[model samples]
Target: MAIFAKRALLSTGWANNLRVEIEGGRIAALHAETSAQTDDVSVDTLLPALANLHSHAFQRAMAGMTEYRMAGRDSFWTWRDLMYRFTTHLTPDQIQKIASLVYMEMQEAGYASVGEFHYLHHQPDGSPYDRLAELSDRIMAAAVETRIGLTHLPVLYSYAGVGKKPLETGQARFGNDVDRFCMLVDQAKDALGNLPEDCRVGIAPHSLRATCSGDLARVLATHGEGPVHIHIAEQPKEVSEVMAGLGARPVEWLLDNVHVDANWCLIHATHMTEDETQAMAASGAVAGLCPVTEANLGDGPFNGPTFLNAGGSFGVGSDSNVLISLTEELRTLEYSQRLRDLARNVMVVGEGSVGQTLYCGAAKGGAQALGRDAGVIAKGKLADLIAIDCQNPALCALTSEQLFDGLVFSAKDEVVTDVWSAGRHQVRGGRHVARDQIVSNYQRTMADLLAKL
Candidate 1:
């Protein structure tokens, strides 16, 4: 496939009248000052699409159902109770439908890849499915139908909380001993035979509270070379629990014990101290920030300045699927930092465009977290890319340097006109090619699910 762009953000910098060539799911060549061919896809602007480095695809169905003011002092713990109850009624088919909708929205929003932190592994009663990787296979099926690059991170969730608490009834479907979890991971990896070559499996140890040190080490030992994600320091209560049970804060404990490197992605490190933030940045692990969901769940703002000053790498994700706008994800991240520090342009590394820094920095960091050889429009990289219509009202009259700023802060995702995942042109004219069927199936599935609820 050949894509001729009037303007494109290459890794080095922006250039005009460039043609990008893709072969074997990777960028094969680039020609400058190029003319568009009759069969080439012409675009106003092109950029490297980002990977959503942290997601719980099944949670997309629970978007607006948890907003009621229930009882005293609503908190993340209280929200978890409601979420746990909702998970019990989901079937494998329903899961697939919801995931399809989520992945479709992601592609439409200019994301070419996702890191699915999947944990709903068994029947509602906690028994393993006839195929141990049934749910994993369903997730893979959704990715296949949507044509999105996937890093399936099957979670090893052994305990309900810190101190190895026994699994609650609502948490049954997510539980697995170390041995069973490893087997499930292996089965999940084996089931990826039909997916695109860019699709692969990773491992997630749900949280420090969900698994002890010994079990975490065991699971990590098995998956030696892929991405590893975990939840950490999203709430003050969680921080207290990890401290009380594990004798250290979540990030501190993990950095002290585990050989955390570029392969690790610590999700929601929102409550770290200065020391912990510096240490985490020095370790080369990416901080997987989900600004929209963190705001929805009342999780505190990440210490962005501290982390960034320490040379940290970070990326944004649409966690909880409450909202899947890549524009909003980057906007909310920067806005959160501003609200915290009472300053403008707080997310930038230096005295340049905040939009470019946030957008490009996230692309690079998210690619690393998902183990994807993407994040930049460059030769020989995976052809994960998006094209935008600069003539859109939100972007009209903007200078080339200010284009990303407009996209990030001023535009919704509608400005996105095309998306290519590993050279697969699945989204065009700002819609996924399979949008109608996926939306129809999701609506039917939700109607049935709501009736059961």
Candidate 2:
């Protein structure tokens, strides 16, 4: 297959009248300054689509229900209690339906892939399913239906909090000792056979508060090849817990103990100290930022400027799946920084387009975090790409260099016209090809879910 774009952002820079060829789900060739062929899929604007590096697809079903304030203070911990209760109502079939909807929405919003940080692994009573990876298989089924590239991170969650605590009732479905967690990982890898070659499995130790060092080491020993993601330092309470229990802050302890490298993605390192921020940048890991969900949970803004100045890599995700817009994620990131510092353009590495820095930086970082050979329109890369309507009202007057700025700041997912996940071409005309069926299934599932609640 081939695609001709009037304007495209290549790794080198923006170019005009480019032709991209794909074979076996990877870009086979690129012709710059070229004319469109008769059979090509012509598009208005083309760029490398991003990966949602962190997600809990089931949470999308609970988006609006958790917005109202509780009796007293409301924070991530309170919201999490609600999430745990909601999980009890979801069966494997319903998990598949919700994930299909989430993946379809992601592709339609111009994300080429997702790193599902999955941990829901058992029955509501906290017992293992007959198939250890049953829920994992459901997530894979969703990916297969959506044809969205997936790097499934089967989570290893054992304890409820720091100090090697036992699992609470709400966390029972997510608990697994090191041995059981490793078994789950093996089954998840086996389940990957049902997905495309572009899809693979990785391991995630939910967080420091959820797993101890010995178990984390055990899991990482056998399954350390693909992407390894973990939650770290998203809240002050979490940091304090880790500091009290581990004798160091979360990021500091992990960096010192673990062999932190490029293959690791540290999700929500929001409350890092200056020293921790610099050291984390030097660790060659991607800071998986989910600004929309962070804001929704009242998590603090990330140490963006210091991390960027230290030459860190970062990516964006719809962590809680409360909302899944690429534009709003990037915009919210910048706005959070601005609100913190009382200045604009704080996310830029230097004096350049804030939109470009945010979007392009995240594109590259997201690919690396997912272990994907994508994030740029170059030959021999995965054809993980999106095409947007440059003539859309929000983007009509922008130049090629300013297009990302316009898209990130002024536009919405409606501007995205087509998306290809490793050449699958799952979304077109601003909709997933299976939009009607997926939405219908989700609606029915939601109806049943609400009635049960």
Candidate 3:
């Protein structure tokens, strides 16, 4: 198949009359200043679709449920209790329904893939399903149905707190010791039996408070070159606990202990000190930042200026799925930094506009974290692209060079008109192909689940 865009962002910036050829879900070749072929699909503008580097699919059904304050002193701990209660009721069918809606929404929002940090492994009663990969299979089914790329990060969550503690009651569904966790991962691979080449399997150590160092090492041994992701210091309470238990801050301890590198994605290292920031930057790992969720949870903003100045790489995610928007996440990341430094354009890389810098940086980091040959519109890469409706009055006034700035900052409407995920046209006219069915299932599932609560 071939697509011709009047304007497109290429490896060498914006080009006109752009022609991209795709074969078997990968870009075959690209040509600039080319005439449209008779069979080519035409588009206004083409942008590289990005990966949502972190997500919890089931949480999408609970986005607005926890918005109100439950108590006078609402915090992440309190919000988590609600999450635990919510996860206790979902059946495999309901899980698939929620995930299908979530992945379809991501596809429409221009995210070609998601690294689902899945931990809901067992039944509500804390019993393992007959098939260890039961929940994983549901997630994969949703991916197949939605036609979105899946980098399933089966979570290894053992303890509820630091220092090898026992699993808490609310954490029952997520519990698995090292041996069981390994078995689940293996069975997940077997269940993933035949999938698209773009689908990948990876492991996630839920967090420092959720697993011990010994188990961390054991899981890393089983890791066969797939990406590794972990939640680091996202809150002051978490850092305090790590200090009391591990005798160092989370980032400091991990830097000293784990051989962190390009393959690792440390999610929300928000509370790193200056020293820790420098060390993390030098380590070559992508700092997985979900600024919208950080703000939602009142988790402190990461030290973006210092981290980037130290030569760090970073990516954005729709964590919690409370809201899924590429522009919102990227904008929030820069806005938070601007507020921190009390200056504009704090996230600027070098010479380009801040919007372009944020997109390109997050693009590279997101691709690295997902183990995908995407995040760039180039030959031999995955043909994950989005075309925006330039006819929108706000977008229509902008020049090709200024399109990103308008889209990222001031566009007032849903300008995205079409999307392609690894050569699959999952979204058109700003809606997923399977949106009607997925929405119907999701609404029914949510109503039933909420009525019981």
| lDDT of each residue in 1-453, candidate 2, tens digit only | 999999899998888899999999999999989999989999999999999999999999999999998799998999999998999899999999999999999999999999999999999999999999899999999999999999999999999899889899999899899999899888998888888999988889999999999888888888857899999999999999999998999999999999999999999999999999999999999999999999999998999999999999999999999999999999999999999999989998769999999999999999999999999999999999999998999999998778889999999899999999999989888999999999999999999999999
lDDT of each: 0.94, 0.94, 0.89
What's the TM for model 3?
0.98
Residue 9, candidate 1: Cα error in Å is 0.4
What local lDDT score does residue 283 receive in model 1, on the 0 to 100 scale? Answer: 98
Worst 10 residues of 1 by lDDT: 347-356
Q: Residue 425 deviation, candidate 2, in Å? A: 0.7
What's model 3's overall lDDT?
0.89
The TM-scores of all predictions, comma-separated, are: 0.99, 0.99, 0.98
* RMSD value for candidate 1: 0.8
lDDT of 1 at 172: 97
TM-score head-to-head 2 vs 3, winner:
2
lDDT of 1 at 413: 93
